[model samples]
Target: MTCKSSTTPVMGIHLHDIHSMASKLETLTKNQQLDQNDIKSILIVIDLNPEPMSIDDELESSKLTRKEFAKSIKKLAELKLIDWDFNW
Candidate 1:
């Protein structure tokens, strides 16, 4: 992901520079409604499964049931945070 500064057209924010600070931003942006555990769970699945991970796979990896993982992914999709495509 590329982060462009609003004030500077020529500058881009490097991921390494803001990587540490994004966690707090993520929490606040998620409306502070989701706890750290929830965010951690989601991140774990995303980080581990770079490919198009099936809902079942994510659930199994995160120790969450299929239903729970589905709900979380649905919310993430609604937030425009992830793009999912189904071929089958």
Candidate 2:
């Protein structure tokens, strides 16, 4: 995303920009209508710097409750939409 706005950071990106991108990703990840929050959560887990993301980390990184996150992850896995290994 090339921003011509004066508020744009000279280098790197603003944290708010990342959140905005995630919001956009909610509707842009697929052609079909899927659970937006679930998709966003999965993207967060996958986009993070390191592999083997922990359950606790996912909970902490997201606004979702443990149960909610687990449910989404499980659903995505069952649909074969995602298959990354994370710490339990």
Candidate 3:
């Protein structure tokens, strides 16, 4: 029941940040695709869970049911799903 890692954040991102944004980003999307230039897009970044988590973890944290969360979203407009398989 513990977060896998706190000190060693994955890709310079922390789980706590995700936990904090959980409520804000819930009912939205996971594994959001973004970069420095696109950071200003609150609609996507904030709406979509900007945190990266494993398929299992994302489903668990999502407000949507486990079966409801869709993995590997092909595209969001011009954006594509960016997922990292680090076993997070």
Each candidate structure's TM-score, on Cα atoms with residue i matched to residue i, is: 0.34, 0.34, 0.23
Per-candidate local distance difference test: 0.40, 0.42, 0.33
Number of backbone-clashing residue pairs for each candidate, in the order shown = 0, 0, 0
- Model 2 lDDT per residue over 35-68, tens place: 6464433332233333475435644665556555
Count residue pairs with overlapping backbones in model 1: 0
Q: Which residue pairs does candidate 1 place in steric collision? A: none
Rate residue 12 of model 3 by lDDT.
Answer: 30
Model 3, 1-88: lDDT tens digits are: 1222212323332333343333333334454634534322222221234346554565555554432322212122213313322222
The predictions' CA RMSDs to the true structure, in order, are 10.8, 11.5, 10.7
Question: TM-score-based ranking, best first?
Answer: 1, 2, 3
Model 3: lDDT to the true structure: 0.33
Better of 2 and 3 by TM-score: 2
